[model samples]
Target: MALTKKGEFWYGTTSGDTQAELRSYSVANEHEASRFAASKCDCGCRTFALQSDEDAGVAIRTCTDCGQEHLMGDSADHLDDAAPETHECVCENEVFELMSGVSVTPGTHDVRWYYIGCRCVECNLVAVFADWPCDAGDAAAFLAKV
Candidate 1:
C-alpha cells in the first residue's frame, strides 16, 4: 500500500501546527508499512517513535504509549570499536516516528530501492536518515529484514 496521509507540512523545522500535522502523516506512514513489517509494543500499542544511527546501521523504535524502545535493522557488531555519540533533533528531542519509501518492480515483488526516514516528534522535521540500493526478491521480507 502507498502512503495514505497528506497535509500541507514541509520537511524541516516546523511550527506547532505543522508539527502535529506531520505527526499524523508519520503515523499513517507507519501504519501502511506495517502490512509488510508488523510490530507492537508489550502495552499492545502499535504506534512508535523512531531514531537511527546510519553509521551504526541501527534503527530504534520507541513505543508511543509506554515509552519502550526496540532496535530495528541489523546489529551494531561492526561498530564495536566506534565512538559513541548522541543523535537528537534541533529541538533536543530523541523521539520520532519512522517513515519509509520503497520502490518495487512493476508486477513483481522485487524491491529496487528503499529509504527509511525519521520524523521528529517534537519539531516534526522529516529526513531520510538511511537508504540503499536493494535487490530484494521478497518485498515484505526485505522490509522486515531492515
Candidate 2:
C-alpha cells in the first residue's frame, strides 16, 4: 500500500446527521479550517465535522457524533507533512501500520526516519521499515525474527 496523501483529513457533513455519508476530506479554506479547529459538531443541523487522521493520532477536533468522541493523538507522527525521507510501503502486497510516534533527528528539525510496522500479506513476513530499499521480496532477510 502506498501512503500518498498529505495534510489533515476530515469527514464533513451538512445535515448534522450521523447517518450522513462520511466523505473523505481536507481543509480547503480558512473557514473550514476554523470550523475544524473548533471541533464543530453541528452546523444548524446542516453540517458536522470529524477528523480522519483522528484514528492515526493527528487531530485537534473533538466532536462527538453519535456518541463517539473524536480526538487528535499527541504522539502522532505527522508524516503527511513530513519530508520525503518517509514513505508509505508501496509494495503491491505489503501493508503498514503507523507506529507509536515519529523518528526525528535529535536536536534538529529534520525527521531522520519514521517507523511503521509492516507485513507482507502474501509472504506473511514481518518487514522492517528503515533506510533500506522499499520492496516486498527484498526484505525477506529481515523476516527471520518471525
Candidate 3:
C-alpha cells in the first residue's frame, strides 16, 4: 500500500485494489494532517501509535517496527513552523541565486546556498528551495550579496 496526498488529505491505496482508502485530520498543517492520517491507516504492515501531552505542548508518534519516536506537535506558535526560511524563489522556473554563506577550514568546506522559494512571485510567498553546497564560484557570488 502507498500513501498519496491530495489537497488536505493523504489517500492510501494498495497495489491490487481498485479502491482508495481516505483519511484526514482536524488540524491545519499538511504535515500534521498527514501524521494524523497515518494513525488511521489500515495497512497491518506499518503501525503507528501516538503519545500526547497537551500541558507540555508536545506530542510524539512511535513506529512499532523501528522503535523510533517522532515529534507530532508542540504548543509553539505555527508561524515559525510554516514560515519560509528564505523569501526569494523562482517558483517553477530555474533556480536563481538569492544569497549564500560559507566557512572554510583546512580540508573542510561548509557552504550554505539560499535559493529563491518555490512559490510564484505574485503569491508573495516566503520560502526557499532546498539548500545546496555552494561551489567556490557560487560562494563568491553569494558572499558578494552578503
Candidate 4:
C-alpha cells in the first residue's frame, strides 16, 4: 500500500482535564544543515517538532496533500547549540535524550548504522527517535562522551 496519510491521524485526546494535538518537527536548524526525511509523520501520533531552511524563527512543515507549509514557533533542532557532529550517532554517548545506546557488530562492522532512542521527558523508555545518518568517528565520539 501507499504511504499516504488517509485516515484521521489521532493527534491527541482529552482525558479528564487534558488535551493534546499533532505537532510538526524538523531534524535541523538554520545555523546547521538538515537531516532525516521530511513530509512524514513521526513514530506514533505524538507531538513532533519541525526544522526549516528559513529565518522566521519558526520551524516549517509541509502538508502531504495540499503541499501547504505550516509554521511552528516552539520546535527546533538545537544540535548545533549543544550537540556537535561528534555526537551524531549511537555508538557513542549521544543516546542520552533521543537515543538509548549505540551498537556495532564484529561481522558487518563496516556496513552498519546507529538508531536513535527517545526525546520525551515525561515517559521513560518511550523511544520515538529515528535513524540518523552517521559514521564511525561520530559514533566513537558519542561513546567517548559517556
The candidate scoring highest on TM-score is 1
How many residue pairs collide in each prediction? 1, 3, 4, 14
lDDT of 2 by residue, 1-146 (tens): 22222333212222221111111111111111111111223321211222233223233222223433323223234536433222233344322221111223344333322222233233322322322111212122212111
**Best model per lDDT:** 1
Q: Model 4 over residues 44-109: C-alpha lDDT tens digits?
A: 232333233222222343333344433322224322342212222222222222221333433333
lDDT of 1 by residue, 1-146 (tens): 22223353344433333334334444554422222233456788755665555554555667878988665534234345334344566567866555554556667777655556555667665655454444546677656644
Better candidate number, 1 or 2, judged by lDDT: 1
The RMSD (Cα, Å) of candidate 2 is: 19.1
Q: How accurate is candidate 4 locally (lDDT)?
A: 0.27
Answer with 1 or 4, whichever has the higher TM-score: 1
lDDT of 3 by residue, 60-96 (tens): 3344456564443221332233322212222333212
lDDT for each of the candidates? Answer: 0.51, 0.24, 0.27, 0.27
Q: After superposition, how far is residue 42 of candidate 3 from its true place, in Å?
A: 18
Off by over 4 Å in 3: 1-45, 74-146
- Give all candidate RMSDs, comma-separated: 7.9, 19.1, 18.0, 16.4
Q: How close is candidate 1 to the true structure, as a TM-score?
A: 0.50
Error of 4 at 128 (Å): 3.7
1 against 2, candidate with superior TM-score: 1
